[model samples]
Target: MPRRCTRNRRLVLVVLFVAALFVPALANAEPAVWVVKGPHATVYLFGTIHALQKDDPWRSPKIDAAIQQSQTLWLEIPNVDDSASMQPLIMQLGMDQAHPLSTKLTPDQLAKLTRAANSVGLPGGEAMFESFKPWLAALTLSIAPLMQAGYDPSTGVEMELKPEFVKANKPVKGFETAEQQMRYFADMPEKTQIDFLSSELDDFDSAIEKFKQMLAAWSAGDVDALDKLNNADFRDKYPELFQILVVKRNQKFTTQIEDLLKGDSVSFVAIGAGHLVGKDGVPAMLEKQGYKVTRE
Candidate 1:
């Protein structure tokens, strides 16, 4: 089991919420808001957490100002509120009715998964676990603890911002469709998926503590700490998964940012904070393309 699994699960499932209180900019600070200047446009790239606790501090005057100034809101996907549409897609991509999930794991792995599942009060029995792909099962198991801890995806940054954007009559766009995002995991090599599941099951408890640390670092705008927690072990142990999930997506989004920069309008782009840190992160990739990304 790779140590990267839990962090990867956190990156995928959790939405990050930054503190509403703005901290004064300092040297080497990695504020959640980054401003980039194009010849005729200004784009604010905001790193977001996908889910948050109900009481998480997420109101910031600076963030509010950015939202007000922007004409368009870009997210990893649009219509996040439409879970009805997303459910079918997730089912189509993540179900493995052709084979039982038990067949893919060893006895030890199965035992660990069951223990973790029960600990989190996951609703499904073995039948439910057997019906899912390893990646899907892993994701379900990973999120259970967070859910138990009172984090709600519906209360995430995207969900919170979408209605405001709509009420303001701003157009919301997506970098990728829901189906495409689902396939990133669905198309993984079976061995990798199994390894990911096993790793997550093995480290379920520690993963919760690590998630807390991640949230704290994110709230404080500690890019170095966030990068270390999110990317360090994952990059070293699972280069291929890292490439597919983070690097490739960053490349594509960077190209889109360049295109957006060519226009005159201001756009606010929100994506998972995991995609905003490290050498292969969106900010770094944009910098490599000669864009000056400054913390706002």
Candidate 2:
């Protein structure tokens, strides 16, 4: 199965709470960073990978410097780690016991899902995931492999960075609230959600491998490679999802960054690496708006 399905989820969902946490900076790592300057404000844009193994190093001195220079940090959400607040929302929007997975998926898909569940050490049994809405099920399946592969969300960039911001008395803002982020998936048409689940099922076995490829590209600061490897196939296979999850969100974020630039404060904006690359990425959008955007 192609890794496109998994790639799509990793790019966006990882930024939400789907993927796990952070590690020290690797001397050789240079994930892409962009400097966007407005007349009065300067914003540093850095792409982030949400889940990473303990051995992985992504923070570079440039990023460190940017963090020091900025008065505020901006992420996809301000409270990504607040599971207590998220659980109720998930229960309300992500469960559908009355409908059940058996009713929505084909026999073949159910079988694949079963195998995927077992591989990830999830409870065995056909009904194990029956109560999950298709989108939630897909996210569950996608996240398990990453965790099994030793990816920790507790160590992800935001997890590591949020604390420093708090200690410094720097405000950490978000492009959206966690509820809005969740609704992006929960509000999808059932057919689209099912298709997302099916694709995830097809790509289950390659989840870790695909993520490694993406991580490599990110670490190398190869935006072109990252774009082709992560965004292209996903955009082609699921255009609507790509638009909703990536493009539209980037557009909004770009606008927000632009507005931030009009102020005198320096801000560092970190988001999913996938949103920092490609034509519709936040950096590109800002460049088109006549801001001085320089790759660092």
Candidate 3:
């Protein structure tokens, strides 16, 4: 196994924790935002790209107004920016030295993985990946290309929005903890994790192009296209991942929004754009519960 030096380990943390989860978008973006109106509560459901290039204008007047009106902010997880708190947890959950990837992947697959890693600038090459669990490897590989293409995770939507709320002393909450979110991948069966990694590696060559398409669709606020581009293939290819990562989480998010409607405060909820489109998305589920969900 390759040595887990400080630089490479920090790279893993950045890729897995920050850059890889959400898609990215471009400037002058309309992107999607839904206003769920209840008798006493108003919750803004805004779709967010986790990483963005410098000067990507993802905000609009409507979005700015909503932020001002809201008293609380909701994100997938609030602790994402707290790397010191999250690093040890990531190490515990994402590493599996006892089960080297060499034993799980065939020699041919290993060779391809090495190539894919190098192509994207992942550190340590084939030997270093030995301790990485399949899910971690897949995430690291998927985002490396985008990072190389100039996406900056530090400027992501969550990163940008969090500070304003903190300075204002407004409460920011999460649908789940960071540990719970990571467990969605870490708890998968070994075979399932390998399959997930293999699928990502198989598509390594076109990941950037796919991301660009997503960027265009999301920037244009094309929910239908987003559904097709982001959800369809993954749902068909890895139903378990689709169920666990998307469907169930959307359900949980919708439920949380519904609970918020039972109260009397305004809240801004920003999550990955993929979770807000499609029929199984949070917006659709909220509509089914008799809330007036208006796309703004």
Q: Cα deviation in Å at residue 12, candidate 1?
A: 13
* Candidate 1 lDDT trough over 10 residues, lowest sum: 15-24
Candidate 3 lDDT over residue span 126-160, tens digit each: 77689888887877776778778988676788888
Query: What residue pairs are clashing in model 3?
Result: 2-127
> Candidates 1 and 2: which is better by TM-score?
2
Give the best candidate by lDDT: 3
User: Model 2 TM-score?
Assistant: 0.91
TM-score of each: 0.88, 0.91, 0.94
Model 3 has an lDDT value of: 0.82
Off by over 4 Å in 3: 1-21
Question: CA lDDT, every prediction?
Answer: 0.75, 0.78, 0.82
| Clash pairs, model 1 backbone | 14-50, 15-49, 15-50, 15-51, 16-49, 16-50, 20-59
Candidate 1: tens digits of C-alpha lDDT, residues 1-296: 56444433333342122111111122333347889999999999887766666756665777888989999999888867765465566558877788989998899988888788778765554555887888788777666677778776657778878888999899999988877877777899999888778767876888778787777677778888889887787788778877887889899999999999999999999888888888988899999999999988
Candidate 2 local Cα displacement, residue 146, angstroms:
1.0
- Across 1-296, the per-residue lDDT of candidate 2 in tens digits comes to 45644433333443366521122234589878899887889999988767766756777799899999999999988986664566667678887978888789998999998888887776544566888889888887877787777776667788788999999999999988987887888899999988888888987887777777776677788789888877797789999988877888889998899899999999999887778888978888988998878987
